[model samples]
Target: MNISNNVSSITAHQTLLNTSANNIANVNTDGFIPKDTRITDNAGSVRTNTREADNNGSKRSQTDLAKEIPNEIIAQDATAVNVNVIKTQDEMLGTLLDIKT
Candidate 1:
C-alpha cells in the first residue's frame, strides 16, 4: 500500500476540517470572518510537462482575528497531532517490517 497518498489525504482532510471547525466556532465572535477551504484538482489539465495535482487552498475569513486566534491555535495543534500520527504509523510499519525480516 502506498502510504504517502493516504497520509497526505488524511492530512489534507484534517486541515480542511480544522479550518471549517475554526470558522464555525467563531461564527458569533465580533468581526470574525470565516475561512473557506478549497481543494484544487490540478490533474485535469496539463500545463506543459507538469502534472497538476490537488492542492489545499485557504481563503480569508470574514471573522475578526480576536475571535479567530483561539481557533487558529486549535487548528495548528490539530495539524501537529495529525503529522505526529502519520509519522508514528509509518514508524510502526517500518518496525514491523524489520521484525519480519
Candidate 2:
C-alpha cells in the first residue's frame, strides 16, 4: 500500500513538472498565463492515500475552459496564417506557370 502511494505521488509530481514545462514554454506568449499544479489530501477518505488539485480557489480558474478559449483561438489564428502563406505561395507558382504557357 505504501509503495502504491509512493508511486502515485511520483506520478503526480511528474504531471506537475510537465504542466510547469508547458507553462514555461508559453511564458512569452501573448496573454499566456502560467498554471500551477496543487496536490491536496482528500478529506473524504479514511487513509487519504492520494491528493488532488484543490479547485476551490484561484486554482479553479486554471482549468477553466473559458480561459483556454482565447489561447485556443490564438493558436488557431497562427496556424491559419501559416496555411494562408503556403496557399499564397502555391498560387504564385501557379500564376508563374500560366505566364510561361
Candidate 1 differs from the real structure by a C-alpha RMSD in angstroms, to one decimal, of 10.2
Q: TM-score for candidate 2, please give it.
A: 0.40
**How close is every model to the real structure, measured as TM-score?**
0.43, 0.40
List the candidate 1 regions with Cα displacement exceeding 4 Å: 1-62
> Which ten-residue region of model 1 has the weakest summed lDDT?
45-54
Q: In candidate 1, what are the lDDT values of residues 8-83, reduced to their tens digit?
A: 5445555655666666676566655456554343444211122222323434335445644664565467557657
Q: 1-101 in candidate 2: lDDT tens per residue?
A: 12344344444545554555565566455554456555444442212123333445442223444443444454455445545666677788889999999
Error of 2 at 12 (Å): 0.7
Model 2 misplaced regions, further than 4 Å: 43-101
Q: Which ten residues in a row have the lowest lDDT in candidate 2?
A: 44-53
Q: Report backbone clashes per prediction.
A: 12, 0
